[model samples]
Target: MSSALSTVIIIAALLAAAYSLVTALRDRAMGWDHLAALGVLEALLVAQMAVGFVKLAGDGKGPDDTATFVGYLIGVVIIPVVSAGWGLLERTRWGPGVIVVACLAVAVMVVRLGQLWEGAVV
Candidate 1:
């Protein structure tokens, strides 16, 4: 995985989290803006996943903990989608709160993903 891409993903996730936090603070339900931010995040995650898969396909290209890294990649991609669905189901401020949690999770996971890619054990 490219560190630059990982950094971008992390920043985007944090921004999304902040946005969701603001929406939740305002006592508003998740709306189109939140969904759009999530959509962008999902797209970035998908791109990251694609790059990870391509790297893994090459001979001995990924980290020693390949299985775990792969798991993280898949999880990062799925989290936003699942959270978005859950958020949409609730018509309350908690909906955006859910997104906030998801975005923060994604940010942390991306950082972990970078460490995994570098074979850092933690």
Candidate 2:
């Protein structure tokens, strides 16, 4: 996994989380802006996933728990989409709140993924 990409994703997710929190606090429902943020985040995650898969496939230099690593990669990619759908359906301030949680979760998951790639038992 590329640390630079991971850092970018983490930063972006946290920014999105902060923005979503503000929106929720203002009692606004999920809006196109929130969805756009999620869309950008999703694109970054997909890029990261692709990089991870390529690295894992090359020269067998991956973590021992390959399945777990793959799971994280896939999970991170799915999270934003699910949350966006849930947020849209809710039609309340909690919609952005849900996005905040998803963004924060993605940040943490990206960190965990890096540790896993390094073979750390976290």
Q: How far is candidate 2 from the true structure (C-alpha RMSD, Å)?
A: 0.6
Candidate 2 structure quality by residue, lDDT tens digits, 19-89: 99999999999999999999999999999999999999895788889999999999999999999999999
TM-scores, one per candidate:
0.97, 0.98
Error of 2 at 54 (Å): 0.4
Mind sharing the TM-score for model 2?
0.98
Candidate 1: stretches off by over 4 Å: none
Best candidate per lDDT, number? Answer: 2
**Model 1, span 6-121: residue lDDT tens:** 98899999999999999999999999988999999999999999999999998586799889999999999999999999999989999999999999999999999989998888
Model 2: residues with Cα > 4 Å off, grouped in runs: none
